[model samples]
Target: MPIQASFPSQEPLGLNADLIRKYNQPAPRYTSYPTALKFKPIEDKASRSAMLADIEDAEGPLSLYVHVPYCRSLCWFCGCAKIISTNTALADKYLDYLEMEVRRYANLIRSGRKVVQLHFGGGSPNFLSPAQIGRLDNILRSSFEFDPSAEISVELDPRTLSKSQVLAFRKLGVNRASIGVQDINSKVQEAIHRIQPTETNIKTISWLREAGINSINVDLIYGLPHQTESSFNQTLDEVLGYDPNRLAVFSYAHVPWSKPAQKILERSPLPTADSKIDILIQTVQRLTGSGYAHVGMDHFAKIDDPMVKAQEAKTLQRNFQGYSLHADVEICAFGMSAISQSKNSFRQNQKDLDAYYKMLDEGDIPLEKGYLLTPDDQIRREVIMRLMCDLELDFQARGESNGVDFQNYFSSELDRLQVFEEDGLISFVEGGLEVTPLGRLLIRNVASRFDAYLGDAKQGFSKAI
Candidate 1:
């Protein structure tokens, strides 16, 4: 059965210079409260042990994030940490090291926490063969007690998928597949060097459906070179024809200075700020008109989708994967450059594969950087998360619930948001601040108002849009 869309379009919204000026500022994605850049390098075994002990003491089920950094080819627009390789031996060796780290963490947390959610993100998880995926699944099961109904999901590169591989994913307990389809325009595809045809995507979608895996997500990107309002509309039309359960419409973050491959793309041809805003407004209108419920920033879903339900119930959570079903679970991330968040702290694995392998070879849990959150960090995190997830925050309610005086703790931050209140971006009511309809487009900016580390001169985050 097709899921009904939830967003309704009334009038086509225009992007004026003032709107562009207001929204054209840099901001973090807020995947974590402090963000990964704030994490300091772990000094010794004691710090690492303390982090592991915290994870061991967590009260509920855990979430696992495994990063597979290998990719068959590079997409110029991508800023992800990935290694391009066709060598099977390299993958085999990487898996060995990954298993070692998994075992090391398992031993540290001896109670064997049950995994409630397991996500495989990548360079491309599909870069591994079906057999390799199965073997990796075995490794996880061997080390942890996976809940029978755990949401096991994987990010797939459609260009590399095979029919057998699709079946193998299901057999290996993958219940969700997120496929990347940046644009269907051939010219745009060529410009980005990611020439995925619509036929391939449709076939993969059909196969996954036939395999009884209905939780399909399609990722689309706007603001790429050669992308125009017409081109994007066409892409959206084709995407809507597929009718995915979830849609992630990301704005392209072109940071050629940071990500060298991005230099391959000609900067001049990329859309202007006004042009980008036009595409975004049009895309949002189209999705909403098609009955897709706006599931906050960069995401939309059918009314019946679990994410939509979560949003309505005010239980939606934002994580590295974007919006998630399991937010409260302690995230245990494995592989190079992965990050795990416990209740009180954040821990990250080694970024370089060589460094990661070296640590595991020496029987150490290759953690590179981390932060132990203070009580203030927790309070600010709660406020920021509420704004990001629910677009509202109850100051007094939070204070009462968490036993922290909201005004005393965040008095300066609240004062900072007064301008937004004046601009009608937010509402200051009796006990809380709620984002207005216009504020939804500036959620990241609004959330950043509460981030203590965001205003530093050294911060190099992307634009909030």
Candidate 2:
């Protein structure tokens, strides 16, 4: 079906300076509620065994996330754990190790455990050839009881995909494809060292649709070097022309000190904060005006999109994959730097491949760091998830009913959000706090106010724009 497009005629909204001032601070992306930084490594076999036990006890279907951390070339702005290499031999070796890891995990779980979602993300999952992806898919299906209706998704770099590759992915049961279209402007693309043209993207999108893969998602960035309102508008127009099922607009996090390769983007200019804000406002207006329902922070989709349906049913969930239809699936991450979350806690694999391989070879889980959620962590996580996903927190209702007083438990945090209330970003109601539309843009900041370990922790995270 051809996607409908419309632009709202309402005047653009301006940024709330006071809200921006009070909440425009660095914060975790909240891919995990407590954030991975809080995770402490499992020091012994006993602890690891307990963690595995928790995973075994969790009910319902599982989600599998496999990280293929390799790319043919580096996009200077990328901060993911990836290796830039042309060695097909290295990829083959990695595949063997990945298969071994998958088998190891499968052995740990009980029989009849079903996988509801399987995602391949990385420097680029499409970095592997068609046969390799097919091999990986077959391995997963053999090792786990994959639900035939499961959402099998993969992230692609259009510059690397071919027609045969798209068809192969469809045959492998990939129902969704997410392509990166950070910016259509050549100057902006050149600045980020990810130079994909309009035709390349168009062809890829068309090919995916042609191959019976209809759910297309396009990713765009707002704060890249050389990204101006005009450039972004052109990019948006170009992207809308392809009519993707979903759009993810993100703010570029410039952390040169952390991701050294980002230092390479020295010559091209970045939009000013106000200009970046302008582009954001314009983009949001454009998406909504075109009839795409605003699916909360940084996501837009057709009103009938599965994600939108999930949101309306209050079953929508946010995770490392952003918004998802499978909210409660126990995620088992495999590969270097991959993160897994069970009902009780979260665990992460070693960040570096060498450390990862070393641990796996030594008959260990290769977990570098992880946190076992305390009862308090679970409570706060529930509260934060409610606030983030629903844009409202029923502290008195949710807390007191759960045997705790909302104010007493989060007194200091409530005190912190006072400035936001004063700034008209959020409001305190009878038994809950509601995030005003203006506050939605600063949801990460608002959520951070409840973080017990934000400033004290030394781990760096992306900025909340």
Highest-scoring model, TM-score: 1
The candidate scoring highest on lDDT is 1
TM-score per model over all chains: 0.94, 0.92
The worst-scoring run of ten residues by lDDT in candidate 2 lies at 1-10
Error of 2 at 413 (Å): 2.7
Q: What is the lDDT of residue 174 in candidate 2?
A: 89
Reference-based TM-score, model 2: 0.92
lDDT of 1 by residue, 362-400 (tens): 878888999989887887777787678777787777787
Evaluated against the true structure, the overall lDDT of model 2 is: 0.81
